[model samples]
Target: MTDTSIPRADESLDDEATTPVAVDEEIEEETDVDAEEANGAGREKKSPADSELFRQSEIAADYVEGLLDILDYDGDIDELVSAGRPVVEVVGGRLQSLVGQRGATLEALQELTRLAVFRQTGTPSRLLLDVGGYRATRRKELAAVARNAVEKVKEYGEAVRLDPMSAFERKCVHDVVNAIAGVESESEGVEPNRRIVVRPVD
Candidate 1:
């Protein structure tokens, strides 16, 4: 009788420990599921915005491709979203003509692409277009010019009026001027004649 009772008590203790282990396993499984769900939710939140941008890019690319074909231009086009905006780049030989002087043609093409997107999606888009990396090269040039203007303004302690620049060029200058201390920049005049004035901040 004693031996049988001891065995029974041990079995009861085993059952108690086993029950807690099972509960712990179930809790761990639930925690894993919850984590996965949280990750899924995070992905879902970001994907829609990115997808819309990508869609805009695709539409812009198609429009550009059609233009290139009509123009008998040989080029490769790449579409992407960068800096919260859609961008299309065209690379090929003899593409400088597409970029035109100071990227005027490229700017026009970009506007047309944006209009195409708006027509399709009923939403206006801020799309950037580059041909043969013109914008990238121009940006570097503009950055140097901005620095030079800022230096001049700092040295003279007077407002310096720069030549009329495109809206893109003006923005680049404004950004650079804003970054430096003791100076600020503003756009003056209208489109095609709009320029940046760098001055010492009072």
Candidate 2:
């Protein structure tokens, strides 16, 4: 998450860019992930301590570890800073239940982990939680989907509606399409059913 280049043509959501994924009901309270950055919106902020973010990731990782223990699941946890945000990734076998369908369980668990961090730090965080490499794999799939949608829009000059996706998935599509020229994308509808429409830019 080093703010890597996001130029188009064979690029992906992993191009070192972070998009605010749509918040599930569980994270509505934490939807304002920008609050920390916004605190210094009009002023130069002193470079934040990297340890703070790392500590946040550590706390989240520990919380996740404890959760795995309760569930009797096995996984290896890695906590690190990516693009200046705390990220906790869990990798292991037979962890599909933790990821749930389309990552709904993962999202809820993320909120819980965040709550744990807030309880410990007294500060709201923008930490990201990934389980079973779901997000990474989803990003690649969405990138392909985005590229295909853009190709259609460029060739036909029409808007294409994609299947409904979670906020995280939608943001992945948007990031891919937004990096390309001659096409643009937007989300329509509401939670759980919201989808993306890619259109040719006139």
Candidate 3:
């Protein structure tokens, strides 16, 4: 049977890091209101959408399971809804191949899993897939990269442009830069070549 229980291993990584504090408060209040509405509407039962999201997660988990089996990989898959999105995490050793270099393969697999969910649900899914905590680890590393760029910009009083990065990586850097004082970041160039330029605040 599929393990639908959320693992505590993933909870330590906060998604709120990307969101501004004020916006996070607003989102929390909205979430509270939504929860109240859901509870009242369902009389303690889950709403249809909540049930559908769980189904999507299940489908995603199964699809990933099949892939792992075909690849002869060993891992434990956990599915859960987090931050209003379905997430599937595969935790195990030797999963670096799934993560690929800089998560390129992981991104591809996520897209495929999302497609599988959409095929079953007839609706596009925003499912997130992580292999061996690669994304969580990468997020921490990217934060440091952002901070280093910020330091350079602050010291030289000139913009520091970083190498091209995927959208997810760029967002990680952007969040870190946004949180720090006296520095700002913006994306320039096109896909596969798009990059972030960190500069001192005006």
Candidate 4:
């Protein structure tokens, strides 16, 4: 899932690098989707009616609940809108399997749920799926990583590059870096290998 607090814009090359992110504060690995394509930005994303948005959330909730039933997993599903995006959160115990390693499984499930919504609505959705508070917890972890990168940049006065992260994670890091003074962040490389580089402002 995309961090609603972070402002997303297209990045440029041959210029001061910047972080450009597209899509949900989701719970993994890259889907090989470019920031633009991943976030459904540019020509792809059209704002749907509010009613449609809610409908998408309901569809996603039904889809997720069905999956849970198949897996014999017990969870309470809550569907709602936040930051103008449809969100489905499943809360319960023994849900770590749904989260997977580093939220990989959760991301996959989210895509499937979105597909379910699209199948019925005939429109792509930005529905976010969060299981067991994974999104919030991951966001905090990402924020800490960003703060650490900023500290290193300040101490060494050299660009500090972080390991590759999903588009959503990169955006979370960007949000933290942008909020701090004296340092900046930009994303480089490609999906599955794309990483953020924190630098000290001159």
- Clashes per candidate (backbone, < 3 Å): 0, 1, 0, 5
Tens-digit lDDT string for candidate 1 (1-202):
1011111223333343333222111121211223334544443344677678778888888888888787898999898766555677889997888888887887777666766676566665766777897766786788899999989988889999999887677766676778899999887777678788999999
In order, the Cα lDDT scores of the candidates are: 0.69, 0.74, 0.73, 0.72
Model 4: CA > 4 A from native: 1-48
TM-score of 1: 0.77
Top candidate, metric TM-score: 1
Candidate 4, 93: how far from true, in Å?
1.3
Could you list the CA RMSD of all candidates, in the order they appear? 25.6, 12.5, 11.0, 11.5
Off by over 4 Å in 2: 1-48
Candidate 1 ranges with C-alpha deviation above 4 Å: 1-46
Q: What is the lDDT of candidate 2?
A: 0.74
Per-residue lDDT tens digits of candidate 3, residues 1-202?
Answer: 5432222334442444312221111122212224434544443354677677767888899989988887899999998665455678899988999989899899878767766676566666767788998877887888889989998998899999999987778877887888899989988988778899999989
Higher-ranked by lDDT: 1 or 4: 4
Q: Where does candidate 1 clash, by residue pair?
A: none
lDDT of 4: 0.72
